[model samples]
Target: MIVTKNEAPANISKAIGQENVTPAWARAVTSFPPSDRILSTILTRQAERYGERILLVAGEARWTFAQTAAIAAASAQALIDAGIKPGDRVALMCSNRPEFLQVYLGCAWLGAIAVPINTALRGFQLSHIFRNSRPALLVVEAQFASAIESVEAGVELPPRTWIIGAAAGASDARLSAVALPARGAAAPAGAVRPGDTVAILYTSGTTGPAKGVCCPQAQLFWWGIYSARALGIREGDVLFTTLPLFHTNALNAFYQALLNGCTYVLESKFSASGFWAAARRHDATVGYLLGAMASMLLAQPQSAEDSTHRLRVALGGGVPPQIHGPFRERFGVPLVDGYGSTETNFVFAGRIPPDRPGTMGYLADGIEARIVDENDSALPDGEAGELVLRAGEPFAFATGYFGMPEKTVEAWRNLWFHSGDRVVRDPGGHYRFIDRMKDSIRRRGENVSSWEVEQTIQSHPAVAACAIYPLPSELGEDEVAAAILLEPGQSLDPVDVIRHCEGQIAYFAIPRYVRILSQMPLTENGKIKKGVLRDAGVTADTWDREAAGVKVRR
Candidate 1:
């Protein structure tokens, strides 16, 4: 149904306890002029207001607001020394570390576009990103230098490479490589506007290669404002997250800390066994968790350390509803559910003690939502339809998909960004998520492109045809499954199929269950009927990789 912020239901108004009133946080942040919404300006303002306060912690490295601002200036100077200019793309491939943020803030300081690549990507996927972004220089961690070298023949890489934590013999002879340069003299911040593009983050594609989403400066500014409000962040709060810096969730956490005057703690990665201990060690008050994280934590043996941490709440997007209460009862922390995307801001959120258990809460103040049919006509409140959105503030959402004009036009058709998720708006104005309308599978917090997986599997010589689809996973997410119709005279084992895909695709994209069929279900045309195969799910005769004790590593 077409629902604007003004047309919100009375029940939702009462549930949220605000009733058309602007939230204090939103009012305070929006009161500033548009010029103040850029990242460089935000950094300066925060440093001025919270000088000497610890702002970031990664491993043993810590930087205060003032120190971070100085580092940003130095980083900007370093990029300029390396021949980077405003609007140039600088690719960065690194894990969760201090340098990731250093380069990100430096890009904002110099008006360059930072392109953060997923470290898990390899082969064709990595090559596609290098070709699409066309970075001027690549700043890569030492361990990942080989991945760039592997794809050197397929695409044109940047002119120079700066290796972090340089190791002997890690440099490639074909490219101009050097150890990461020392900090340059401090440089002045560039004059950037709120509408300027600051980053291009690539998300998994449904029918084609991954597309880079062009995020404007004001969009991330609003991300910090809205996410902080949703998580109930307060000054002096310790924000902790184990999510990788390549994705929006972790990046948003950094802004949440920056805008809220909190301290952000970054860990290298997530481990269910060490989660609580890490939280306790950091004295974290606010935490972040994505798909399957909470379930994995619950699966750990009960311990006294669960309730010992100081974590009051966590931003638990994509967490299962069944474990919400159980987790809170055991850990003394609440998991707030919310909805957002790489191209969108924090659009919907619930309160600490959510009124409804599983539904995505009412729309935020500066956004409008619509539940529409295939023809873009509004549906009834109870009927399910595709959820589309529009932001009220100027430059508050991503401009478009980078270098893909047709995809951008198709996604933003009719002046609204189309979300490919099917949802239903209840009479009381709560929206519940249904299955995805797009052909994508989400596994362990990563979006696995079924089209890409199918392309990789079909490259095998013995495979005549293949279909990839999602199977119900016990951890409240989808698992990849493949159905293959082999060549008439050839026989193949499922393990061999996985072996062929080892370095070609991501480990998570490899199918867990495989089935071989003599004939395949077909549509009226010649295309395979993936819906029929998805309905059949994992059969008793399917070859199970985990059952066979086969493991795929990064």
Candidate 2:
């Protein structure tokens, strides 16, 4: 539902207030030493103050704040020593691990720009990013080193620049050529500021080739502050991250943990069986999730083990607030809804209890958001329009997409960054997501929201997940087409699904074609890959469970 600018959202302040339960120490730290420090500065400070405290825990290895800082400093010095000057780009390809954090912080320390590539990408897709960023240096893992080696054979990188992790084997010549030091040394004489560009994170390649988002160091530093405040992170909190390091969610989580003087627990990836166990092992108070992560956890038939987690918060983005209550009630943990993108970081977030079902929570303090139509006219409350936001808080926005000046200009047109997302505003100033502007389906001169259709179709008892799209109709126009995933052991009967949708949705909104799949194609981040589905065409050639005309109700 679209919200008007003046309309009040349902009473959701209670939920917002509950999430603001910040600890005393975190609040004290924010006030005591009010200095503008980069992430590297925060790490160095923690090294001095909490030298013995475990700053990072991954696999069987652990690094204290002092040790982590020393390694990062040495690594930074090694890059500088290798002719990697300030502002050079460094691409990182590794799973979620301590080395990833080291690379992130180490790059910051050296004033080089970090470009973390998604570990899941392969061949041409990976090559595209490498070519786009044109990094002077690449810090890769042994497992993915071969992919880099293959790319290196064809594309030459700048001299004195390839650094591989321990996985490269102890005797490898390339590893020695780019070996990082084991101790700290004085950084080269140069001034690093918060306003300097620190990293260029590529957007998830769901729509097309990803664009590099240029985030200023000062903005990123401030992001740590706003995120910490919004999520209620604390000094003693253990932030658990299973999301890929290449993604903004994990990197932001790591930065937030460091700023709060908290311990960060790293998991190579997300697994339902090991999720809670890992949290308990590290005494983690907070965890991160995407909507698919929650659904995957929910799909794993209920067990008493489900309620055994020690997590105080499972905060992240894309979770439909519809499942928020059930997810919390089932796991005995609160799900904090936050919204951000590679282009914009943490623009809005939702708090704990009293969170209205389906709402994206309230706008973060100091951030301003509005619903504007295609003509850039601001819409009143209850109307759905393109969501635009301006930063009121520090590190709240991105400078632009690197090397794409036109794209950057387009994104930040009229002063506010265009999120390209359709959203509704409540009278209370909170925004509820409707759908992506590109994700909406147009049929019969009417707009059909895929998310609204997907939500209603998913209510079917036999359906596990659904992806709705627009397809060519006999009427020489587009019509709705839906691909559904069945609940385990449940079979898909197109006729039954049509009957179920008959009264639940409008006739125009109902899908004309229903295809069942073992699974829906998804992006690395688990968002439904509608483009892939669209390419597959509307009607199923085979594997169909119903006849051509499967109409049920009018």
Segments of candidate 1 deviating more than 4 angstroms: 6-31, 167-172
The alpha-carbon deviation from the true structure for residue 495 of candidate 1, after best TM-score superposition, in angstroms, is: 1.0
Model 1 poorest ten-residue lDDT run: 6-15
**Residue by residue across 7-117, what tens digits does model 2's lDDT show?**
222333223353445553345346434344565666777678778888788887788888877777777886777678789998887777677777777788878999987
Q: Highest lDDT among the candidates is held by which one? A: 1
Give residue 408's error in model 1 in angstroms. 0.3
Pull out the clashing pairs in model 1.
none
RMSD of each: 2.5, 11.5
lDDT score, candidate 2, position 308: 82
Task: Please give each candidate's TM-score.
Answer: 0.96, 0.74
Off by over 4 Å in 2: 1-35, 149-190, 205-208, 439-539, 542-554
Error of 1 at 169 (Å): 5.6
